[model samples]
Target: MAFDSLGRFGVWRSYTGFTPEEAREYEQLGYGTLWLGGSPPADLPVVESLLAATETITVATSIVNIWAAPAKEVAESFHRIEAGFPGRFLLGVGAGHPEHTGEYRKPYDALVEYLDELDAAGVPTQRRAVAALGPRVLKLAAERSAGALPYYVPSAHTAQARATIGPNALLATENKVVLTDDTSEAHSIADGTVGFYLGLTNYVSNLRRFGFTDADLSMPPSDRLFDAVVAHGTPEQVVARLTEHLDAGADHVGLQVLGDDYLAALRTLAPLLAARS
Candidate 1:
């Protein structure tokens, strides 16, 4: 798989966040992929809308949660999209959060079963990525899918994931970034953005990899944790923070704009972010 097909930076936003035209403009701005952030259902056709709006940007599901979207249905959806769009869609699948999953048994085993289902249904290994954070899942991703898609992690975790997954697989890390010069507003916005994730054990557990202790995991989080996970500052500063992932061996960085006026933020940010790539 050509991990570079996703380019250096992808906009990680929900399909509901932008209009079809805005999705097209993202392509014009040189982003190689549109990371549709929500765990979309099996019959998601928003991918086609984005592809039709643009000639070249890849549209990847930041993940299609395995719990809700059955593997057979998702594989059929992937097949349908692949038929129309060719190599444009990359499927990202994950075992979702334990907090949200009621019947969440052994997550690792569930993920393996899901992957086996995808494989049996004719989904090629190179066409999908696994949303992995821990060592076992990271290694499983390298062996079973295109690569790893890690969300809410700092560059330190990216480096660790890359080493664990080895050199060949894709490392697409999602970083929540706020492009604002107002320090107070940025922190406020970042705090709101991270507050919900702080309550999720999976997210907080994954964050601990970046040297975050229980104290740092408290509500509002520590400044060290905030600065590491949420990149907020002027455009150049944000770009530098995103670059840390690349330098740490990320194949692609999916930037999820953590503020209102996402299109404006992406328009303001895409060029600056693209300039670095």
Candidate 2:
């Protein structure tokens, strides 16, 4: 159940902006995988279009939330896509955020129950992954699935995750990249992005664990904190920052550009990443 040929680093694209043509273009650009974000409902046709358009690239959900997509429906979609695409589809599921899910309870328990249902429905553990952050969920991800896909975390968390989950489980981390030389402007855009996650307890707690105080995690996000979370500056600098996660033990890294024009950013950074690879 290994991923077909998705390289060590992949692009995190918004599902809303993705088209069949764009999906094929990404495959042509040497992007091994495309992580679709913004919880898409279990629509096998849409998923099939994405898979059908690309020959070699893997299309994964940054996560399909348990609350929004039921295990049975997800299993149906998994089977539909895998039947056609085989190893090209990777199921990334999670217990989303409490704010998003109106009736949030013990997420760990809910996630376990969901996985149990997925298991019962015949979705292989090796074909799936979990969106995990803390120790407990990360441990569960390792035991129950192929690995964990952690978001909004720094390289230090990757090191901690690798140690906690051990060597075999896939440790993939998402890093936000803004290729702008203007520090002030970059922080402004980065701050707006960081502000949204600031309210999420999981992100806040993880930042604290990485040595950021409440002050550092404030709404505006102190410069030090911004620098830690968002990789800014030239393409070379962004590449250097992203490499930290790979060096820290991440098996793969997902890059999310801050602006709307990702093609330009991809063009700028692809060469740098190629050199690093």
Candidate 3:
């Protein structure tokens, strides 16, 4: 059950925004994993594309929405990826928000049911992770999946999630990132990156649990919350901030660098991350 294959850092982006070219570039930059963030469909052609473009990089879904993608079809795709690429694909599954899915009731039960179907279909439990944040889902991830893949969380939440899932599960937490020395620019990007997620009750509730007040959870989250959730500053400062997650027991920091020029930022961050290695 060791997560030795996953390494300590990876790039996180919505699959729709990704290209094979970027995957190849990340591989050259020495990143270990490529995480496709949005809830992608079950066919997993995007996963194949990224995997095909790089030899050693592992590709994972930040999450394939349980309500949008059926487990049986997803399992079929998992088999295809496994047969073709073996240990290179990780299926990160989750129950999406109630606001987004028409049938989003009982998220915890839905996640369990979807995982049950995956079990029936012979998708090895070690190959998948749960997009979990709260205690109930995090515990279920610990008991059932390879890890807890939590998004939009601070290092404090990462530490708490590590505690919730215990030591064995991979606590791969996502951190929104921006590289800027200007305080205004950093705050601008940080607030903008998490603006939409602020509306989701699930993310809001989780932040509240970690001591974020109602004001801190507002549209443009308070400075404290935004700073904690997004890694920003110079390359060295950003590296230091990202290092906090690893220190807090995260198996990997899923770097969702916020900006129009993501690759440029990744390039700037690559050397700093490598130095840590």
Candidate 1, residues 134-175: lDDT per residue as tens digits? 999999999999999999898999999999999998899999
Model 1, residue pairs in steric clash: none
Query: Candidate 3 on 1-277: residue-level lDDT in tens?
Result: 3586676889998889889998999988988888898889989768888888889889999899999889999999999998889898889999989889886689998888999999999998889999999999999998999989989888888889999889888888888889888878877766766778888899889888888998888877788888888888889999999999999999988799987767899999998897875
Arrange candidates by lDDT, descending: 1, 3, 2
TM values, all candidates: 0.97, 0.96, 0.97
**lDDT string, candidate 2, 57-124, tens digits:** 88888888898888999998898888888988888999999887898999999999999999999999
CA deviation > 4 Å runs, candidate 2: none
Model 3 error, position 203 (Å): 0.5
**TM-score of candidate 1 to 2 decimals:** 0.97
Q: Evaluate all candidate structures by whole-model CA lDDT and list the values in order.
A: 0.88, 0.86, 0.88
Worst 10 residues of 2 by lDDT: 1-10
Cα RMSD, each candidate: 1.1, 1.3, 1.1
How many clashes (backbone atoms < 3 Å, residues ≥3 apart in a chain or on different chains) does model 2 have? Answer: 0
TM-score of 3: 0.97
Clashes of each: 0, 0, 0
